[model samples]
Target: MQLTVAPIPFFWSKDTWSAFYEEIAETSVDRVVLGELVCSKRLPFFQDQIPGAIERLIAAGKDVALTSLALITLKRERKLTADLVEMGLEVEINDLSVLSYLPKGTNFSVGPLVNVYNEGTLRWLASLGATRICLPPELPLASVEILAKEAEALGVTIEVWGHGRLPLAISGRCYHARLHGRTKDNCQFACEDDPDGLDVATLDGQPFLTMNGVQTLSDSYATTVHQIDQLRAAGVTALRLSPQSQGFADLCHQYRALVEGQCSSEAVLNAITGQTPEIRFSDGFLTGDRGVAMSTPPIAART
Candidate 1:
């Protein structure tokens, strides 16, 4: 399997976002989906930089796609969605409303935030000219296997959410803004302080989730080190890796090595933990268990 970098979910400065994509252009990732996916307000800070980033990525032989806002509600937002088609790049629809805006017969993609829980939904999306789809992180392995088969028969490629904090939900209410005693309009970009998202915890202070403006995410980074073989065996074509605050380029190569059999699971786990020792890792969503659960083969764990 190969890698497709998901759009940046957290709020970051223009320089940081630009530099991150510049570095990504040189990585082994096969494709990238980039844009303001969470909040439209955050777009102006870095929207101008997108063309340059996309140009560089394409110049380096990477397939690039623009993403629709995960929650498009307002009139201006609708205009933005409608305008995405005019950019002349593949558009990955996170919200179903985008389907209305895409020109007929345009071959687009679908992001994980959209629900594709069954073969019927997958088939419907395939009928709508969707060429690629990154399945939601919460899908079980059985579902993935079934969907992969359906995608192959329908001439569509299926990608899995291979790594990164699980994006649990997106809301019209900004949790960051509410936490700081403000409304969505008055959020003042509170999410900017947490580049990787602010950690949310239980009353006893156990890490539970993360809040990135309107998006709720898992505190643990989800990795597929132990499940890659099974996924490949099931005919999965690609793995989507979400962008993090740091060590992502190195993380990309490590995943590539793991897929190519050049590195052991132990080496990958070690490399990942060594880079960001504090972040938790999980793989349970694919295992038919609670989303946060983690397990490994004895050989993989001991290696």
Candidate 2:
């Protein structure tokens, strides 16, 4: 299976964003998805830099696609969606509203956030010009297997979320602002403080989820290193690795090694040991269990 690097879900400075993509341009990943998918307000910060990044990745022989916002509400956001097609890049629709903006017969991609739950939705999207689709991370193995088969029959590529904190939900209210006791409108970009995302703990102080502006994610990163064989057998075309704060390029290389059969899943997990002691990994969504359950064997003993 090919490796695809998803767009950064966190808020970062313009220089940091540029540097991240510059480094990614040289990674072993075959595809890259860029553009804002979380908050429409943050678009202006890095809007101008997108063209340069896309050009660099494309020049480096990587297939690149742009993403639409997960939630499209405002007039400005609607206009942004309409303008995305003008960039001449494949647009990954995170929201269905983007469908209205895409020109007829223009091929697009479907992000995981879109509710493509069954064969019907998958076929409909394929008919609507979706060349590729990243299934929602919450899907079970049986669903993935069924959809993969259907996708292949329809001549569409199917992808799965392979790594990174699971995006659990998206809300109209900004969690970053709520965390700082401010409203979404007057929050003044509180998300900038946490480059990755602010951790939200349970009442017992256990890390439960991550709060990123208006997006909510699981604390544990969802990985599929151990399930590569099954996914490949099911005809999955690619594995998407979401961007994180640490060892991202190394993560891509390790996944590449795993896909190439040069390294085992245990070895890939071992490579990430020192990066974060608090790191937790899960693959249960694909295994048909709870989203946060770690179906794979633990790499290091947790305290």
In angstroms, how far off is 65's CA in candidate 2? 0.5
Please give me the total number of clashing residue pairs in predicted model 1.
0
Clashing pairs in 2: none
What lDDT is obtained when candidate 1 is compared to the true structure? 0.92
Listed per model in order, the count of residue pairs whose N, CA or C atoms clash below 3 Å is 0, 0
TM-score against native, each model: 0.98, 0.97
lDDT of 2 by residue, 1-303 (tens): 899999899998899999999999999899999999999888899988998998999999999999999999999888999998788889999999999999899999999999999999999999999999999999998999999999999999999999999999999999889878999889899999888899889999999899999999999989998788889999997999999988899999999998998888887888876566568888889883688888754353221
Candidate 1: deviation at residue 205, Å?
A: 1.0
Can you write out model 1's per-residue Cα lDDT over 212-290, one digit (the tens) per residue? Answer: 9999999999988888888988889899999998799999999999898898877888898899899898998999478
lDDT of 2: 0.91
